[model samples]
Target: MTAGNPTPDTTAEPAPGPESHPEIPWERLSARMVWINLVRLVISVVPGVLATAVLDTPTGPAWPLLVASAVGVSATALACLRFLSTRYRVTGERVERTTGLLVRKYRYVPRDRVRSVDSSARLRHRLAGVRVVHIGSGEARSSFKLDALTAATAEELRRELMPDAAGEPEEEAGRETLGPQPGPHEEVIARFRKPWVLYQMFSVWAVLVVTGPAFGLHWLLQPFGVDLLELVGELVDYERRGFWWSLALCLAVAYPLGFIGLALTFVMSHWDFTLVRTTAKGHPVLLTRRGLLSTRTVHRDETRVRGITFREPLLWRWLGLTRTSVITTGLRQGPDEDSAAGVLPRVRMWEAREVAARVLTGEPSPLEAPLRRHPRGALTRRLVWAACGPAVVTGVLFWLGRTDVLPDRAWLVGVGAWPVTLFAAVFSYLALGHALSGSYLVVRRGAVNRSTVALQHRAVIGWTLRQSIPQRLGRRVTVRIPTPAGERHYVLPDASTRQALAFIKGSTPQLAAQFIGEAESGGRRAAPPP
Candidate 1:
């Protein structure tokens, strides 16, 4: 085949790409991984190691510093070795990984077993233009990772492994989408807003920082002979002011600085986020990619998504903000698990519901279904449980006051908390409900930070009924629906014995009929007789 005289059409070879020639070679991780690991060690591990050295200086010329240096060097060497030993490739038949410098372990995953593909890039990896590709399977422990691949290479493997993740759409929830929907090749499902990060200003972390910090930066560095207040005074060239005014000014300055730090964290994790709908092997996938410094992309098989969870904390709920996440199987949740499952950041409640409808493919959000309130016995159960704590505290406080060690009014502290506890119990009772919505089973629970879950019927793998002594006494039972997704189970607590059985029967007709008997008039029925 000379230049201009092309090879015969049939004899022409297909493009030498991943899908075209997966037999390419046994590829090693990026060489830049060495530098990335070194940087990370310096930023994360080295500082703490050096701090430990400062606190305990092991006598002769700081042996601790030498030890820290040795540890950092050893760790960096191990990382480099790891980079050399790790090799992975994608093939038409299966994906394979070979590791272990000495033992040489070989692992293979059949193409069909590939359940999810996630790629992540932290600040160091981003600087090196590499990403860590995490390949997951239905079996939780079967997941493996290939770190330090060039971004292009990681993207290629992801496309090759998740074939449907290319340019196609699956079922087009577009028609049912009440929110942003995919159009043509532009599959933008959800786009993150910068202002959404502001919601974190009201987060528990921010509140704690403002009201009662567990520890302060000054506290941490003060041991190292650094006084933050003195440094601030010297920098500003201000003489010593009144103690209370200086303290108040320090607190005022620290509060905003703490909030700024929180805001930075939010931005680092969720800036420029997007959720898109795409296809993988003829099935639709909810693809979410986000992050500022440490970026991540998660390809969630829509088929494996059991449900959507709209979590509304007390503060967020009052502000009408909801955070959205999915109950998807084989997600391989880690320390940053919330971010892995989250489809939308804290957003308006209506917007969150709209996003839920878009992902779940329903007209009215499954969350909109009218939930049947739990029986009054459930309320009684809550009251009894809520009262136990307050009663015990009040009795202890009364005894303490009676002993003359504590003031008579000291017991009032415990008594005052009772009303708040009772109010919470009532709210918990009111929030308890379950309903069937289309192909989804909707359940709402919790007094604070209420979670409304809309679980898909087919996703439920098993049913469990537990009637504890207390539940039996109250004529109530707890029904647990187990699924491979999310927390592995969803619970409906304190339903009437009869209604629990009835709910199970309605949700899974064939399976329930084989076990649960008809409801009795007293809302109690005998268990299956041996």
Candidate 2:
């Protein structure tokens, strides 16, 4: 045979095929997920069965129901198995996901767009020798989940995906810690050191436990023709056989027990809790711990942070606990998504401020300083008008009762309306006072929900000062500042023309100059007066 030609016998001997692809270790969902799903299935089926039995539905179709449930469970189990059997191959350049029997899906997630990689192993998952890896990419703005990976494989995958490591001597490896390592500009400004477990349990009880049981009891008793208040009275009598004595005893026992449960839950939730600041591939990584349940690590691009807010809820204030969060661009709407967007786990308010100063602003501003706002009466009048709705409704109800247009038994309307009016008036006054108190508009805007609005001095994209028909009649103005990303506008519902102009001048001097220049140019173009 010629050098390029193969004989029939040579072809039959099997010519070299393309390079064999590496085998990807197939993985399944962690046993924990399986267990959790199983539990959910049981919970679903048991409730349906119980509900059917309670309603005395004909049992004729019971077999079908059972069969359907089993089929569903099997289908889900098979899907998870298929996922586990699927393998991902990561080369020096790209990540590829290949799977499916009849139909196949092959996706490539380039390494350059990957913003972060996270691996987690819950206690149950650890037992099952599985871990979940989350891969986040900026381009697609989505995250990929890889489950049931062996710990070693996870580490290998992480190493492969990690951005090119800074070339450092091998000797430096031994000095580095397993957790995040900070950059030169970043530091752990403060540590939130608390008896976390105690605090967590207390927080859980105070926030949720009491309300849950109270609501449950209220609902359960209502269905049985029982009144909660009456039942409570009876229980009180049973305890001491005397009304006053029983009341005192119940209060004494309930308060301490409630507090104990609160304390325990706090302890459990905050167990081994720690917050750390580190530079991950040059971005600030905030690592928080709250018990062994799971460890949450958040990474933020410092440039994307729009505002930092530190809040101390009334209850947590006493315990020296504070919640901190940031406002950032590209956030999805809704509290849950917003929470995922920029929320930091609850921490001491002071610590939050300190961290913000160090990471966001480079210098700490006093956390207690009151915010700035527009003139007081102007803002208050608008708030008062808004608050008057409830009062007006209450007044109408009271007038109808007094006029006997409604039954005399409805006299309670006037009595109830008194409280409603007082509440509305107080709220209106506070809202108005807050509006008028320029402190509310101060650059640092958040106490409970904090936001700071500041524009680069030279980066003003557009400025508009407008007055609506009502606002014009009322001599009020609304100021809008538009940036490339979006607009930040404020309504000064009541302000004179001069006051509005002056406010704009003080807030954005450059914007005022631009506006004045435009006005002067427009005046020049106007036809000469006759």
Q: Report the number of the highest-TM-score candidate.
A: 1
Instruction: Return the TM-score for each candidate structure.
Output: 0.72, 0.56
lDDT of 1 by residue, 127-233 (tens): 89888777767555567888778877876776676654334332111111112223345367689886776777665455456444423554444545666657877
Regions of candidate 2 where Cα sits further than 4 Å from its true position? 1-123, 129-186, 195-207, 210-266, 271-277, 281-290, 312-322, 328-355, 361-370, 395-470, 474-530
Candidate 2 Cα lDDT to native: 0.48
Lowest summed-lDDT stretch of 10 residues in model 2? 168-177
User: How does model 2 score by TM-score?
Assistant: 0.56
Model 1 TM-score, 2 decimals: 0.72
Instruction: Summarize candidate 2's per-residue lDDT along 222-241 as a digit string, tens digits.
Output: 43355676677676776447
